[model samples]
Target: MHEWALAEGVIKTIKEYSKDKKIEKVVVKIGELQQIDIDIFKFALDELKKENSMNKLSIILEIEPAVLKCRVCGKTWSFSENLKELDDFIAESIHFVPEVFHAFIKCPNCGSPDIDILKGRGVWIEKIKFKGE
Candidate 1:
């Protein structure tokens, strides 16, 4: 729910920029670490653009992993790699309904939980393709 509130503002900005030009699609570069629910963001966009069909640009997410960098060894790793157990556990708990993997960052190289975040930290509008000219 809190994520939704933050996303509403993003949607507003996206739409405002596309006010003059008819948008073809909206491309969002979301860092894997942001942990945003894509479903919620899409739903919000769909609802908001229901009125203006041309303004209704489809949501395209460029999902990058929220990665951590090892300060000691200078290695980079993704949090997704560490979620195998959690993913399996969720599926088993849900009776094999097919679930997605979710994991936390804990550096394997140095075994340090204090690794620096290298990428995938925030949500950004990378580019917006529009039907102009």
Candidate 2:
């Protein structure tokens, strides 16, 4: 899964940021739009930690819901609210090309195809709790 690559990047970033310090905990915020497999991501992190002898490191993952704004009506709403309206094929298509979601999905208020995602677009490291020397 691509989550492995993402986990690897996270690990690398943490190693760089922590330097000689020991890492105690890491909190990651994952956007819902990313559709990451949490199990795979966790497994990758665990494996990396084991390989690096960082058994004490604790990993926390949080999922952020996507928020979308309508360009025509200025209406904002959670993407989860309208998920049921999407057909299976359209959903699959959007999963491949998220930028084209507006082409298939319309604003709930004005029925306009013009839309913009206000939040929950990518993954990020939220917090890092480290042990002081």
Candidate 3:
């Protein structure tokens, strides 16, 4: 799964930032639009940690919900609030290309296609706790 690659990148980044220090905890914020499978991501991270002899490291994942602003009505709402409006085909399309949601999904407030995603577009490391030396 691609989660393995993502996990690897995270591990690499942590290693670089830690610079030989042991990691006690890692907090990751995953955007809702990214559609990351938590189970697979955790599995990949666990495997990577084991490989790197960091099995004791704690990984925490936080979900950042997608927020969209309607350009027409100037209203903002969570994407999940309008999930029922998305058809299977459109949902699948958005799952692959999150940017497409603005074009295909209309604003719930004014039914306008002009919408701007305010948040939840990318993955990031929120915080890292290093082990005491």
lDDT of each residue in 1-133, candidate 2, tens digit only: 6678888888889989999988888999887765677888899999988987777888899998989999989999998886778888776666555666777778889999899988875568999998762
Model 3 sits at a Cα RMSD from the real structure of: 2.3
Question: All candidates' lDDT scores?
Answer: 0.62, 0.82, 0.83
**lDDT tens readout by residue for model 1, 1-133:** 4445556666787768977767777778877655567787667666656644535467787887767677877888776675454454553432222112222345677776557767776677888787763
Using all chains and alpha carbons, the TM-scores for the candidates as numbered come to 0.66, 0.81, 0.81
Error at 76, model 1, angstroms: 1.7
Let me know the TM-score candidate 2 reaches against the reference structure: 0.81
Clashing pairs in 3: none
Task: Output the worst ten-in-a-row residue range by lDDT, candidate 3.
Answer: 94-103
| Runs off by more than 4 Å, candidate 1 | 51-55, 84-106
RMSD of 2: 2.4
Clashes of each: 1, 0, 0
Which regions of candidate 2 deviate over 4 angstroms? 87-100
lDDT by residue (tens digit), candidate 3, 3-101:
788889998888889887778999998888767788999999999989988888898999999898988889999888766677888877776667877
